[model samples]
Target chain A: MVAFIGQLGRNVIHAIAKLGDASIFAVSTLRLLFATPWQGKHFVMQLYAVGVGSLIIIIITGAFTGMVLALQGYHMLVKVGTEALLGSAVALSLIRELGPVLAALMFVGRAGSSITAEIGIMRVTEQMDALEMMAVNPQARVMLTRIVACAIALPLLVGIFDVVGLAAGYLVGVEMLGVNSGVYIGETIDKIALTDVYAGLTKSMYFGLLVGIICTYMGQRATPTTEGVAKATTQAVMICSVMVLVLDYIITSFYL
Target chain B: MIKTKGLTKTYGNVAALNDINLHIKGGEVTVILGGSGSGKTTLLRLLAGLESPTSGSIMFSGEDLAKISRKRLYELRLRVGMLFQYSALLNSLTVYENVAFPLREHTDLDKEVIHTMVTMKLEQVGLRGFEEMMPSQLSGGMAKRVAFARALAMDPQVVFFDEPTSGLDPISAGVISSLIHETTVKTRMTSVVVTHDVQAGLDIADHVILLWQGEIIAEGKSNTIKNSDDPRVQQFIEGRPNGPIPFSRSQTAYVDDLTHKPGCVRLE
Candidate 1:
């Protein structure tokens, strides 16, 4: 028991130290992000990769999620004789929770994992060292571009997801199930405030920043080996997914 | 001109480099020779400002590297260039872009000037027509040539080559060695090369330093290194199996291991 406790303490301390290091890395990158000689090309390329590359997955996830929510909510509302509330339920869920959380999760799986792998490969191949030798700031050139791109991309992606999901919900609830199109549209608009949309956007922005930082940090700190790169990529995806869920809960609890 | 004073680097309790002092002259090829794990690469990395020493100081043209700010260090680095063991070209970039990258990032030169410089450097490395090719399509020798072209793109005053001939055929190694020699002579740039190849080191070096167990065991003209009295130096250069440097790193008794099974065996 004593040995186990000692090992546990050591592990906890190690984790805390790693977290501190990552925080410092993020702070330094942000401080150098706007320094002279901006990397406009890299930023634009990353924006295309993280945002445009992720569009198809986001659309599919949004559409299917809305359909499922409407199907389930229609059954419950019918039983309660409150079928008119179906639109309110679907819109509230899509805007307030599902859109941001699910979009962020998918981003973590797709863009975040690839970013980690790419950076890890750079480290393994000595390309990062090469950059340093050339007197180029790797943090500014690599991390800052990707992070800003992600931050800009996530909110737009969340908006798309929310819009697509709402449309799908309308198709299922109003057109297919005959829930009354006018009532559904009117109830959804009445129930959703501007603040809910703002809240979801805010959540997505934070998620994007966290995922970018964590993935880049993992990749930069990864050991220079094939196995090490693979491990870092997996860790980036796993940690970002968990962080998105946890942060979503915290933000929702406070904002709602 | 570069010099080190009592330079030491340690990883935890184990020292990768011990207290050592040396001078690297200007406008000459200086070769650092060592067996594996002899801290040759570590010394090169420290000189290139890629790593900081645990203790002691590195003076590059009279500026102390350790005391300088990151910005100043970066400025200092712009005057230096290095070729990595594996070429280290940006895999995402085409050959033309790889050589043109430093020029694009560090200078305000117009596109025409940049293109001319890239073409000239590639031609110097004998890859003039291979500009649009991706790094993945190039052979190992071609990749190293491209990396060399990239290293020279900034017209640095000093160039460091870390195992330039490693992972290449003998003819390719000879070509790389001749290129290093010709480039250094033509540009009159200070060149530092780290290698284990005895013949290549002797053939191209104006000065040579041999490292053993994180310490400089020999330092003099390359020709003199062959006749050195140090058993370690002789063992290394002559490639002898029996010498002060043990071939096998087993500390346990050989007979005891054979007769009775030990609790655990450590492999180095």
Candidate 2:
């Protein structure tokens, strides 16, 4: 029992130390945003990598998720004789909840893991140390640009996800299931408030920041070995996915 | 010029380097010779300010590197250069871009000027026509040469090399050692090299420091190191396995390890 308690305490302290390192890294890197030499080239590269690179996956996932949600909603609503409400149901869920959550999750798998691997490999290969020797601040050049790019890109990508998802829901519910097309389109317009979008985009923006910080932190602290880079990549993806789901719940509670 | 006073570095309770006092003269090639795990690379890293010393100071140009503020040290590093064992070229960039990276980053020089400078550095390193090739396409020696060009991009006053000859053929290694000798003579840059290859170290080094178990065991001119009477030094240089530095560094006896002694843990 004493040994077990000691082990537990050691793990707790390790966890706290890791948390502190990550917080310091994020805050210091973000502080570079206000500095001069605005890193325009690097920022644009990251937007291409994190935003444009993940475009197709996000669209495909959005369409399929909306179609599935609509199918499930139609069965349950038809039982209560309120099947006409399917459009509003799908719109509210996609706009207020699923859009941001699923988009963030997809971003984790698509971009976040690749960022971690690329940075982690650079760390392992001593390229980061080489950069430091050349007096290039890797934080400003690598971390700051990536974090800001993800923050900007996530909201824009989530907007696309919401639009595509709602359109897919419309295709399945009105065009195929024979629900009134006008009711489908009108209910979607009537049900979703601008505030719902603000909330979802807000959640996505925060998820973007969280993914950026966690992935970069893991990569930056990688142990400088092949297995180390692989582990950091896996940890980045897993942690970003889990955090997106958990934060989605917490932010949704605020809306409620 | 660079100097260290009783410099030491520790990871957990084990010291990687200990009580190292040395001075490297300006515009000279100094080779730090040691076997693996003797902390030569650790000392190089400390001098580069990549890792802080646990105790003592690294003095360069009247400033204590150990005590310098982080921001100040980064600024100071602009005058320093490093060539890694693996060459550490930015794999994503072409040869021209990699060599031009430091200049493009730190200077407001026009693209034309940067282009001229990159061309000159690459030409100096004998890689004049390989400008558009990626690092992945280069041979080991070629990659190392490109890295030398990159290290020279800023015309740094000092350059540290970590095991530059490790993964090369004998001819390539000789070419690199001669290149180091020629570069230092031409540029007047202080050079610190870490390597276990005694022949390579002796070929180029004007000054040599031999590290054993984290401490400076012997240091002098390269010939002095070659002729040293110390059995440990002889053991390393002559490649005799049975001597002061044993092959297996395991603290525990094999039996104790198998029997699970208090401090002995099984290998992962």
Candidate 3:
């Protein structure tokens, strides 16, 4: 027990040191990012990848989620004949909880994995060192662009997901469950406050920043081996997902 | 011009480098020859200001390297090109992009000017037509050539090679050595190469420093190292195992003699 406690304490210290290192790296990178000139083509390419390329997955996930929630809510609320509340409940849940969180989580799997693997491979090949030698800051040219792109795109993507998800729920509530279209839409619009939308968008922004930093951090810090890249990719996805969930809770609590 | 004063690096109980001092003068090829783990790379990293030295000062052109801010160091680094052991080409970029990367980053040259500059650099390294090729598509020698092209893009005052001839065929090694000599002379760039290939080093280095056990065992002209009376120097130059360097058996035999046991059984 004593040995275990000692090890735990050491680990905590190490984790704090690592966090400090990451913050320094992030701040230095941000400084360079703001100083560099923005290239339109590169920014557009990254934005398209982060935004448009993610559309199909977000829509599919959001639509299915809405349909399933309506099916389940019908059974639960029918006991009190308050089935009409299903649209408002689904809209509130999607906008305030599911839309941003789910989209961010999905992005962590796709884009976050890409960032980690790309950076890890660059480290293994000494390409990042090469960039440094060339006076081309990799953090600014590569990582910062990805971060900014994600930050701008995640909110847009989440907004789209929320709209689609609510619409799907509306269709299920009215056409499938025989709930009144006017009543469902009216309740959804009235009950779901504008603050909820703002909170969701804010959460997406934070999630985007977290994903960008964590992915780049793990990738750049990867060891000089093949197995190290795989480990970094896995760790990046896992950590980003957990962070998204945790941030979601905090944001939810703030709004509530 | 680069100089180091009393540089030392210790890892726990092991001293990787011990209070060593050296000077690399202008417009000459200086080769540091050492076996693996002999602090050759540690010395290079210190000179490059990549890692902070434990207790020494590195002076580059009379400016203390340790005191140089990261921004100034970056400018200094731009003046120095280093060919990494692994070539270190960006994998996603084509040969042209990799070579043009430095020019693109530091200068506001138009695309046409960048193109011309990249072409000139590639031609200098004999990689002109290979601009379209990806790093993965190139062989070891070709990859090194592309890396050289990239390094030359900034027209640096000095170039460092980390084991340039390592892991190459004899012909490829010879070609690389010639290229190093030609490029340094053509560009008027000071070259510092770290190599275990004694013959290759002798062929290119105007001056040579033979490092052994984290110290400069020998330092002189190439011809002087070949004729040095030092037995360790003799062994290293000739690639012989039986000189001042004792093999693994010698230590074990001395220990056994102290214990009065020729061949002891296993403790278990």
DockQ each candidate and list the results: 0.88, 0.79, 0.69
lDDT of 2 by residue, B11-102 (tens): 99999999999999999999999998999999999999999999999998779998888789988888998999999999889999999999
User: Cα RMSD (Å) between model 1 and the true structure?
Assistant: 2.6
| DockQ winner between candidates 2 and 3 | 2
Candidate numbers sorted by TM-score from highest down: 1, 2, 3
Model 3, span B1-268: residue lDDT tens: 9999998877777888888899998888999998887889877777777677888888999989888787788888889898888899888789999998888778899999999999988887778888888899999988988888887788889888889989888887887899889888887889999999999999899999888878889998999999999999998888887878654445456645666666665343
What ranges in model 2 sit over 4 Å off? Answer: B250-268
Better of 1 and 2 by lDDT: 1
Clashes of 1: 0
Instruction: List interface RMSDs for the candidates, in order.
Output: 0.6, 0.8, 1.1
Model 2, A1-256: lDDT tens per residue? 9999999999999999999989999988998889647888889989998999989999999999899889999999999999899999999999888999999999999989988998999988888888888888888888888888899899999999999999899999988888999988888889989999999999999999999999988988888899999999999999899988998889889889
Question: On residues B113-207, what C-alpha lDDT tens digit does candidate 1 reach at each position?
Answer: 99999999999989999999999999899999999999999999999999999899888888899999999999999999999998899899999
The lDDT, on a scale of 0 to 1, for candidate 1 is 0.93
| Positional deviation of residue A1's Cα in model 3 after best superposition, in angstroms | 3.0
lDDT, each prediction: 0.93, 0.91, 0.85
Q: Give candidate 1's error at residue A233 in angstroms.
A: 1.6
Best candidate per DockQ, number? 1
